[model samples]
Structure formats: C-alpha cells, structure tokens
Target: MSLRTLTLSLLLTLLAFGPLSAAIGVPVTPATTESATATEAAALEAAREYTASLKSMTAKERRTLKREQRRAVKDALENHQDASTNTILLVILAVLLPPVAVLVYEGELNNKFWIALLLTLLFYLPGLIYALLVIFGNM
Candidate 1:
C-alpha cells in the first residue's frame, strides 16, 4: 500500500479502537486477542480496497470524492455538536420544567410530553426522573 493509505489505515485503526482500549482496563485474554486481530485485519483490508479504488479514478473524480468525504465528515461533526448542546439544554430543562424538556427532546407535543406533563402535575420527582430517563435512554 502507498504511504497515504498506510497513514489513513493507522489513523482509522486508532480512531476506531484506541479510546475504548485505553479506557477499559480489562485484562487481555485469548478471545480478546483474536477479536483485536480480526478488527485490525478488517480495517487494513478496507483501507487497501479504498485506496485501490481511488487509484483507478480520474483526477476530477478523486477531487469530487475528497470534497464529498470532507463535507460528510463536517456534517457528522456538526450533528454531534448539536446533539451535545441539545442534551445539555434538555438536562437543564428537565430539572426546571420536565414537560418542556420532554417536548423539546421529542421535538413534538406527543404522548411523551403529555405523560411528562401529567407526571409533573401529579408529582415533581417522578416527572424529573421520567424526563431524565427519556433524555439519556436514547443516548
């Protein structure tokens, strides 16, 4: 494989598994070792296939591919950021107004919002708990 492919493969491998592996302090076993090897092999193979396809494409096609990839990555990042902000806002709203939080999280005045409103009206704690569960459950 070319240098670009190799670099991309290594970056992907790290991005895919590095954080989880570092965060989890589980001891390595035969099963874990086998799975790790399989994952690495799959990543390498995917990178090779991607690079091979790129090699066969014309310069214009490559430029278009790169542009599309960049746009996709940017959109994904923006979506993630929006989700984080929404979650934070929802958490605050859940504490202050459980029904409103549910409505915002659900993006509509539906059954969930009605349930939350009822719960909040009947008892504050239950409403808060339900709102938190609904917000965090989907995550």
Candidate 2:
C-alpha cells in the first residue's frame, strides 16, 4: 500500500474505535450521547467515501497521483534549499557591510537601505544586527 493509503487506513481505524472508547468508561448524558452519535456517523461517512474513492481509481491512476505528489515534494525541497543558500550568502554580506546587504536583499535602494545606512553611520553593531534581523525574520 502507498503511504497515503496506509495513513488513511490508520485514521479510519482510530475513528472507528474513538466513539466506542469514549462511551466505554464515561457516563453518557443526552448531550454526550448525541455528540458520540454524530462523531460515529461522520467517521462512517468518511470511511465510505474513502472506500468508494479507492474502488473508483484504477492502478494506473493511483500511480500517476503518487508520481505527481513526489514531483511536488521534490520541487518544494529544491526551492527551500535555494532559499537557504541565498539567506546564508546574505548573512555573510550583512556582517561585512550592513547597508550594502540591505540594498542587495531589498533589490533596490529603498527606505530600508537608507535606514541601514543611517544605523551603520551611527553604530556598526546596530546596523549589522538590523540587517541580519531583516534577512532572517522576513523569511
């Protein structure tokens, strides 16, 4: 079975047992009884839907779906790695020159760059810290 199928199966198992377990040791008032009945009905409906979907799909379709999921995950990981590398480079530049790092990160000479320049002129550590915070916190 695929990971998704296994996960859903586990979920179904939990849902099936949840109401029974809740009723086992607790006193069921009318409100609690109604709540449990609703929970059970919802779980049954979900199981039916899941089983129906499974029956509807062919093996080929399932394979295609899994392939698409894998591709999406791979693309996301690649994008995350690229972002981390860029952040690291920016951090290094920020430590060396705060105003220039802000300008590069902002992709223009914006007000942020001016703020960094002003901070750097007054005190080096404050500007470096501000540039680092902008690069890290914004992400």
Candidate 3:
C-alpha cells in the first residue's frame, strides 16, 4: 500500500476505535461525534492501561508485534500495495520530491520513475500527480 493509503486506513481505524475526534483536527459525523468523544477517552485510557501493562508482556509477543509492524512498514514503503497505507511522511515526500518516491516504490530509477522525473523536470504539477498515481499503484 502507498503511504497515503496506510495513513488513511490508520486514521479510519483510530476513528472507529474512538482514538480520534474533531479535537484532533478531523471531524466525525454528527451522530457519532458524542460517541467518538467517549470512545476517544476510553481509547486513551486503554492505551494508558496497555502502557502500564507493557512490562508484563512475554518477550516473544512484544518481539513478534514489533517484527510485524516493521514488516508492514517496510512493505508499505517499498511496494505500491493495497489496503490503503498512506502515511503523512510518504505524502509529504510525494509532494516534495515525487520522482524520488517513484524511484523508491519502483525500486530503481526505471522507466516509470524516469518518466516521472522527466515530467517533474519539465513541469512540477504533472510530475507530482504522476508520482502520486505511481506510488498508489494506479500506474
């Protein structure tokens, strides 16, 4: 998944779990706003509780979770995969240097990346848009 997609999925997950609310910048549906706020508070409390319990975890479980997270992040950064994995940093990178992002996703400065780079060199807008598409697997 693209970083953009990953970030959005994470945001939605947080929203659904009540870990986010308008107070954080994104607005929730009016019908769910109250629920969201309540959920957010609960989520915070749960997180705090988990933090307190962290030391109680078996070392293997913690290592497994860490490994999984690392693998997911690595896959997201290197592959223009699915399941919506957009991250803020990836979005910023895409915006600031689209060609480089394309190269990273493509794993080389290959044809697609070159095209993106050329477009970027020729015109910023086309380059940026093309890079976004490429990184998101549209290309």
Candidate 4:
C-alpha cells in the first residue's frame, strides 16, 4: 500500500479499537493516572482562587478584571479547547464554514475534518451538529 493509504488505515484502525479496548478492560497501572489527577486537583484549586479573588474588586477594578478574565479564557480555549485557533475568529469561521471550523479545531487535516466535510456535503445540519459536538467536546 502507498504511505498515505497505510497511515490512514492505521489511524482508522486505532480509532476503531480505542473504545473497544477500553470496554474490554485493557490492563493499565495506576501510577500514570495518579499524576494526572494531581494536576487536575491543582488546576481546580487555581480556579477557586481566581473566583474568590474576583469577589472583592471595586466597579472599575471589576471591569479591568473582566477584561483580564476574558483574555485568560480566550487563551486557554484557543490553546487547549480549539487547537490554537484564535477564539473569536474560530467562532466566526465555525458559523460561516462549519467544516473549516472542524479543521481549525483539530489543527490538522485529520479524520474529523474529512468526516465533517463529507457530512456537510451530504447534509448541512448533520455536518453542523457534528462540528459543534466535536468543537465542544460533546462527541
């Protein structure tokens, strides 16, 4: 097989296998998951601190605080949520061209893009729904 075909096949195979492997109870140790849980706890603590700090600001301070919060939220969503696409720009693109939204959200021309594009061509609603789901981590 050609390289592209082989790679695509492998990707699809792994995609198909992942949920089944999880359902079948693949063996895994707890050490790696423990570190991940620790990081989540730290992040949760930071969020709590942020919310508490917001409660004591003056009106002008609250306006500045909101702008800062917006910047931080946008940065976090861009880097982690939507694969580094500029948040406002990505939302506009998502509204105008849904498949392109999927491409940007994934940061690659991957399976999700192809699937969204195909669905879009076949029917706009399904494509839009799938793109939204993927973008929002619902699917």
Candidate that would win on TM-score = 1
Q: Can you give the TM-score per candidate against the true fold?
A: 0.51, 0.47, 0.40, 0.37
Per-residue lDDT of candidate 4, residues 1-139 (tens digit): 8754564465456544656768589898767888999999999999999878778777889899889989999998887754344644654565557799989878899999999899878966677668767887843
On lDDT, the leading prediction is 1
Ten consecutive residues with minimal summed lDDT in candidate 1? 7-16
Q: Considering TM-score, which of the candidate structures 1 and 3 is the better prediction for this target?
A: 1
Order the candidates by lDDT, highest first.
1, 2, 4, 3
Order the candidates by TM-score, highest first — what do you get?
1, 2, 3, 4
Candidate 2 vs candidate 3: which has greater lDDT?
2
**lDDT for each of the candidates?**
0.82, 0.80, 0.74, 0.75
The digit string of per-residue lDDT tens for model 3 on 13-123 reads 654565345447785546578888999999999999987777788999888878998999999899864533444445457677888887777777689988998998997
Candidate 1 pairs with clashing backbones: none
Residue-pair clash count for candidate 2: 0
Q: Extract clashing residue pairs from model 2.
A: none
TM-score of 4: 0.37
